[model samples]
Every structure is written in C-alpha cells, then in structure tokens.
Target: MGGERVGRGRGTPLRAVAYAAGGVVLLAGCASMPDSGDLRGVESTPRQDTQVRVFAMPPSEDASSAQIVQGFLEALTSDDPDYKTARQYLTPEAAKTWRPELSTTVLSDVPDAQPDRPDQDDTGSLTYTLTGTKVATVDAQQAYAPASGAYNKLVHLTKRTKSGEWRIDEVPQGVVMGKSDFQRNYMSVDKYYFASNTPGAGEGFLPTAVADPVYVRSHVDPTTRMVRSLIGGPTNWLKPAVRSSFPPGTALREDTGALTPDDRGRLTVPLNDEAAEVGTARCEEMAAQLLLTLRTLSPAVEEAELRTGDRQLCTLSQKGADDVAGRGALHRPGYLYFVDDEHRLVRIAAGGSDSQPDPVPGALGEGEKALRSVAVARDERTAAGVSLDGGSLYVGSLAPGGALGEPVLRSRGKTEEDRLTAPSWDAQGGLWVADRDPGEPGLYLLAEGAEEPLRVRTPDLDGRVRAVRVAADGVRIALVVEKGDRRSLLVGRIDRSPADGGTDEGQAVTVVGLRSATPELEQVTAMSWAGDSRLVVVGREQGGVEQMRYVAVDGSTPDVPPPAALTGVKAVTASEDERAPLVAYSVDGIVRLPSGAQWQKVTEGTAPVYPG
Candidate 1:
C-alpha cells in the first residue's frame, strides 16, 4: 500500500493564513499560493434529502477518467468485477480517447457491511474514506437511469439520474466540486484560455522560448495515478518564476532550487527544495505536467514561472521529439513497447503508416539522435542481446557517458546476418524472433540468456509472415500471415496435454475467416495484442489507406460475432496500464489519449524519441 492522508471530513475548514488582505497576487509565472482559510476543518455537507442509489449501468467502453474512478469504487462492493459499465458511458470518440485506461483495473478489499436498501435510506454512506475523484463529460443525447441502492455488510448506496438529463459528471468530492462556482462563471464565456492562451503576456510573467511537446508518462503503482516525465522541453525559458511545489495532495513552499543544464544540454530542475517544502508525496508530482504551451500564434511564455511567494521554484517548458532526417517518412518504429519485470515482452506496440503522427512540433537534437540508435540495437535478438521493456528503460541509451559512443551492440553470426527486423518480447522471459531459415520461414523463441533457439513452427500457416506478438500472460501468441495475396489471422496456443509434457502439436486457431479473406488487406504489416483475447492489427486497405482493426480471439466459441470495426488508426502503442491498452496513434500528426475526454496532439511531423 502507498502513503495515506486523512482529511477530517468533506466539510473540514481550510487552514493556513491568507497571504495578504489583497489576496496573494499570482505573478504571471507564479502559480503557487499559501493555503487559505482553515484547512484542518474543511468539510462538505450532503445535499438535502440525501437519497443514494446503486445504479448498475454498464462500465465505460473506453474507461475515461470518470469511468476509471467510478469503476474503481464500484469494484469495492459489486460481485461482477468488470469494466463494462465504464465503457457504456463513452461515445466512440471519447471511448477511443480513453481506450488505454479501459484495460486497467483496481482491486479493493470489500467492507464487512453495506448500507441499507435504496428504498429505506435517504442518505447513502460508506465506511471507507474516499481519496480520489473521477471527472467525465456525459452526453446529452443519451438517457440513463440510476440503479436501486443495495445494502449488505459492505457499503450503502442510493442513486438516480438527476432529473433524467444526462450530464458529464465527476465525483462530489472532486477538485471541480470546490471550484464549481468559478467553473460555472468561466464556462459562461463559452471558452477560456489556459496556459499560453491567457491574455496580456510578458517576460518574468510570460515570455517566449520553448521545448517541443511530447512527454513520457508513468503511473504510480496500485493507484494508477499518473506521473509524467519531463523530457526534452525548454526548461530555461521560464526558470525565474518557479515557486512552491506539491505532490498529489501536499504543498511545499521552501528550500527549492534552480534549473541547471547538463553536459548533454538536457535541463535538470532541482526538486530538493520543492520536495522539502511540500513533502515527498505531493511535491513528487507537482512538476509532472508541462507548465506552459510553447506553440501559439504569438508564442509568448507568460507567468512562465510558478512561484510560491519569494522563492523561484520549478521552471516551464515545451515538449516534442524531432526527427529531421526521418521527416515525412511512414514507417512503424516498434519503439513503443512493454514487457514483464524480467525484460521479456508481454506485449508490443502495433500500428503502421495508418496510425497518427506525433502532434507536438519539434525535431530531435544530436543527443536524441544517438539515443534512438542504441534502442534499436538493444532490441535486436539475433545477436543474443537483452529484450527491452516499455516500463523498464535502458538508462545508457537515454543518457550516455564518456565516448562509449552511443551503446551499440555487436551482431550475431558471420557479422552479416540479415538485419534484425520485427524483434519483440514474450511473457515467458524469452525473445520472439522471425526469420526465413533456408526455405522454411517461421518464428522462433529465444529464452533469456540462452544462445540456442527453440523453433516455433506452424506448418498450417500459409503465405509470408507479417508480424507476431505474445500476450501478457504468455498463454497465446498472435501471428499475421499472408496467403495468395489475401491475409489471415491465426492465434496459436501452446498445445500440451496434462500428461504429455515434452513437445507441441503446432496447431493454431484461425481467427480470420470470411473477413480476412479479402485482397484489400494485402499490405498488412503488424499486429499487437490489446487484451487477453483482443488483438489490434495494422494494414493497408484497397486504396492504400492505412488502417488498424480489432479482433477478439474466441476459438472455442467460433460462432461468436467479430469485434466492431474502427478506422483512422495510424500508430497504436500498448499503454503501460493494461486496462488502457492502446494509445498514441497518428493520422497526420500524433494524437494520444490524454485522459478520457480528449485526444491530445502529442507530436507532429516525424516523431522524435526521448532518450530513455
């Protein structure tokens, strides 16, 4: 379990003295403020006639932020531990926006008792303290009814739709709840600009210098709370206005330092001061998001710094990776991938030119150039090298030292073996390699640290092999094959009887039948597993338009209908969280799932890679 902070109740008064009678002036770059009001006693009172109901609506299809939080709380009591309800609330676009989060799940211990039935209790109360909020925009077009509240020994619940009108919703205890009045006012103008969009910008408050947009994000374990890595953004542009920092919930105001540039020209903002002031828990996440939007018509960085009173704290920056040489190219870089703890790939990033391109503007510098080269080298399997995990990174590749010259690896066999292509990791801590062995072309598995190979042959497989991916659990593998100008999908499960422990039958369940027998998919290039049974395949259609398709593996029940069809998928990568499996596809530029409600442009033009 992680650290916990206990709030007295929803209505506890905010503590801490006000900065001044005039109210703390938020200098342009300064975003920090001292706690006002009585923090220790802050609380909330339930609405009148507090009737609660437990609605059994379907889970979100894409599990956006709202669904994620709701599903998480629901898991604490319901007998059915699924995310279906979460998915039901999302529209196709919104579902796709939050598709990644849909795959992740949270487990909680059930309470000993639940509240009484909805018909009886007006106020719904539970014993556990709620710590987080889920925000989601509901659709006005759809109408949903809340379920009847049920009480057992677990939790109490009563709920009903608010006047039968749909509303994009958030938890009652969410941050939005506190600022509801302000939000109502702000939205009244139809739109309000945040970050660079704020008017009247200038230096010290708003200036101009930026980092390309596109940052790698990692989430905290057990909670799925996100922690964004500040990669190649312009740190020096807004170094002066830095101030106090906060972790998830704690705030700090003292001891923070300045931002420094490393030998590689990368910026390193000292977090020691912010950590000391806010405490590690909250300050750790304070600077996790991009402080300012670098790209704008005017391009001015304002309030560029986030100051907490007198101290110059964290700096601001822009984000994005650049690839000057690879600009305008349409190739799948297999760079976005994830594996188990041992560096064995449980999944792979699947998508092609049909996927989207990076949305943020910017190209890679010389250091970025060197790092990307090494990542490809480490991912090579023919040379008996180590497999790379999406979560487990190669630090040397990201930040090199001395003249070791970019951490390149040696090739296996005669120094002339065909260049390694389509390299991927498997769940059993092995590397899956595809090649043509003298008229017999197929895929093979190379276990960790084992030079010798155990071949995986599927004689029934026809045509040339396009791509292969091993599932997270290592229970099955997805293989794309082309036969007679037509493509087909095959799911092969290791066939071993309870008694016959030695060899495999080499049998596979054909997933593509009537649908896969089309000539339009002739250009199929790659495939990735999105879930235990769902697969995302990338290929070109009749017009050479790139496309990504989803299929569910159900060999035992072949009669089941196929998955829904979705196009405009450019490049798809497996998300760090299984519940939110696919992400960051590009159409013209790269667009990724930022949360459940929006698709953020992460990069534009040829995408650049952030070292490590």
Candidate 2:
C-alpha cells in the first residue's frame, strides 16, 4: 500500500475573532482561507441534495491507541478536502508521509480494530490490526474495480514521551472505508474519447465519442476534476480501444482553479502549453469532448471555450460539439420497434408509449415473413430481422417501396434455440449477430451489411455466446454467455485490423479482453446498452429473485438505483438516449418504464427493441 507523497503547503494557524456588528464569535482556522491578495471568485456547482455535513473531531487528551485508530478511520470518511483532521491522529512524521489520494480500499463494512501486543522492549508503543472483507478498490486514477477477499492492515501507534499521548506512527498509505461511505463520497462520471482506428467523417462515418467512466469525489470541484481526468486520458482497460483528443502531457493550466460555468452558461478552460499550438479542427474536437463530459455534471453549460495563456484556442457551442463527434445521447430514436402480436415488425412513437403501433414500411412489416427478432440501424434507414424459426437473417430498407432481400445469412442448427440470436447494428453501419449452433457456434459481423458475414474471433470466450449487442461506439460489445446451466454477462473489446499475411478484404476481426460485467448474477436473461458506457441488464443472483440493474463497462455498479422491478422479464431493450423510455417484454407483454414512472403495458408484443 505504499504510495508517492503529494505536497500540501503549510498555512497560518487558527485564530479567534469577534464581529462588532452581529456580536458573533468565530474560532476559524486561518489556514482554511486564502491569504490577503488579489481576490478571485471561485464558482461552484450547488450541492444536489441537502446531505448532512460531518466534520471529523480531533483526538481528545489522553486518548488510547484504539481511540486514535477509530478516530482516524472516521476522519477518512469525512469530506475533509485534504484529510487534515485525520492527520491529527498521526505523529508529525507519519502525517507528513501519508498519502490518502493514492487509492481507496472499500470494505463490506466498517473495519474492526483489534489491539495487538506491544514489543516487550518497547512497551510504550502499541499496534492495532484492522480487519474487514474487501469489496472493491478505487485507484489513484479514480477507476473502480470489484475486489474480493480479506483486508488486513496494521496501524502502529507510539506514545509521545513528553506528553504521554498516543499517536499513530504508521498506517496504510491510502484511506479505507465501507462501501456505503464510498458511494456517499464519490460519483461516477463518463469522460468522452474518440474511438481509435475507426472510419472518419470523409468516409461517411462521424467519429463517435466513447464513454470512459471513472469515479470522482462528490461535492468537490468535480467539473475541474473531471476535466483534468479527461485530459489525463482514458483508463487502462479502455486505453487500447479509444484515444483522447488532447495531446500527450496536456493538462489544465496550473493557475486555473475550480471551473464553473458563467452567468451565460459558458465554461472557459485554460489548458497547458501542450495544447496551445493545436490546429483549429483538433482544438474544436477537444472542446467537443470537454463540453460533452461536463454537460453530464452541469447541464446549464451550453458552450465551452478553450484557452492557452491569453490566447483562445477554440470556442464550441453545444450544437457545434455535436457535429464534431456523435454522442449517442444526441441521436434519439424516433420509435420503439418490436415484433408485434401478429409476428410483424411494428413501431410506436418513441415518446408516446401509449400510441398505437403501425407496421414498419418494409416486406417484414408486410407480414410476408414472420420475424422472431429484429435490429434497426442507428440511421433507421435499414433493418435486419431474424426469421420466426431463427434460421435466417434478412436485411431491408425501412422505406415503403423497399423489398426484403434474400437471407443474408443462415444457420443450420437443429432447433430454434440453437439458431441466430438477435442482430445488432454498430455506429459504423456494421451488423453483428451470434450463432448458437452447438456444432458451429460463432459470432459473425457484416461490414455495412453488404459484404459476406465474417466469423469474428472470440479466442477468450469460455462458453457459447447466447446473445450479443454492439455498443454505439463500435469499440465494445456486450455478450450473454452460457456455460453448463449458468449464464453471465461479459463485455469485450472489438479489434479490427488487417490479418497477418492477408489483404484488406481479409481483415482480422476479434472480440478480445472479455471481462465479466455481472459476476454477481448467476443467470442473465437479457440486456441492452442503456447509455454511453452503461448496460441495463436482467438477471438473478444465485438463489435470488430476478432483478434489473445498470452496470458500467468497467465492471463496477453505477451509483444509480436499480430500475422499477418487473417479473418474468424475457427481453429488455433501451436506447442510447437516456431520456428514452425503457421497453421490455415480460409475462405481461410489452411494457415501458418512463423516467420516474412505473412500468406500463404498451402492447401484447414480444422481442421489443430500440434502434441499435
């Protein structure tokens, strides 16, 4: 748990003052206030809720070693910007070296401090062992990952010879707290990045923004913190799949502090010299990333201006930012489509769940061929459907006079359950599907829906892929895999490069680095990409009831509460647009759950879906 030290400048001591006007007595720490100089306004986002503030109390006189350890633990959970009060429990030497920002060890519950016998020769000193069940960890990068096993650490305290007071001399490098405290003190924010090695604007594909979510301290200067994290780059897991627009070593100008939007909803960011010379196009892209990331924190921020020293690099409004990169949230699907009771592809207005659904304009919607499942392209111009028997997949335009093309791909499995899973369309106009055929099980991809379906390599897969959904960024894919009798959700990175010793036509396509996104769930029935880096999943824990929850791509649960519960959820679908209603097919037929509302029946339909 050793960590590098971060410098904290010493300031003046506390003082007592009396105000003549109000007869108010104040005992304030001079170190907490800025020194007399040119005053600058530091704006901040208002607290979202009226959460009670808890301040850590300094150790009392003659406190025992155990008391010191307990107080320090409590202080770690307080909102003490720099853990100043926690240092009061440590010896001056220890206080100078401890680094609470290195990482956060989250336990299942508050740790138990057990006293340990002192050295026989050094009876004046005492030690306490902290023990708990480790639940997860947030690294220095503020990335959260699920962890398991016992947490054991030692806190060594020494008695000051002159005062005979117990002070901790040695402790773990980083802070430790329970899961609840971690949730209370931190929040998840998705910083934007562009997908790497993808088609560009000239190729008819807009560079898509991929979300890289990381946890940051809540109630702190989160806007500035998030901007810094964005400039720092994506997390380790997503680094290979995405690239930041900021140049290497780019960072916020050291003098700029606590970024907040002005009265007109404009945020100006001052960057280091590394970004000063970037071209207008690249600078605008960088501003676009900043605008999208900060909009999640402050919706009032309508525009962003980037500066280096006194020179303005670029200024981008919200609409300009949208044109620079395709943020999935900006492209809301117009309708929620599903396989109706008539087994035809029909759609209802996305906003009006109660509105009547009409068959889509195409051969599949004409009922010439019954469909089992379907996926519409992000553009809503073309659609792919799996036949009722699940043996064939057909692609056709969504226009009135468009004809259904012949089966683009077919599976020869013995039963419907062993045939093709639901199809998914990526942002690059590519199509994805998985075959559950035991004899020839595989994941397949069709580039632009015209080329022959290529077999995607899943070298890390442990079981048969039961379902598949490609994210809007096209850099990642979600999979429901079955092994033995259990099913689990896994997210994998998609890599497309030319195959070794082969031409461009034989590109090497693989879904690699598969990691469990829902390790707690014993079975996953269905899932859908609900947001930038989040998935709405339907699953049940071992020996537990079915439930729906949002899981981030990093394999950590988001801070949001689970959606309203529904029973027997067979299929679930959500739009990348967070404002869109959540649609699902359960025992009660097709149902929709609007934001802040309970599930309501939409129609007697199955295989409900939103444009991928």
lDDT of each: 0.30, 0.82
Off-target runs (Cα >4 Å) in candidate 1 are: 1-419, 436-440, 495-523, 540-546, 555-570, 576-581, 584-590, 595-599, 604-612
Candidate 2 weakest ten by summed lDDT: 1-10
Q: Write the per-residue lDDT of candidate 2 for residues 3-57, one digit (tens) a residue.
A: 1011111323212121222322111221222323221111111222424344456
TM-score of 1: 0.30
Candidate 2 clashing pairs, residues 3+ apart or interchain: none
Candidate 1 residue 111 C-alpha distance from true site, Å: 50
RMSDs, each prediction?
A: 22.0, 8.3
The candidate that achieves the highest lDDT relative to the unseen native structure: 2
Task: Write the residue-wise lDDT of candidate 1 on 136-178 in tens digits.
Answer: 1111111111111222212112222353211122222111111
| Stretches of model 2 off by over 4 angstroms after superposition | 1-53, 118-122, 200-205, 353-355, 501-505
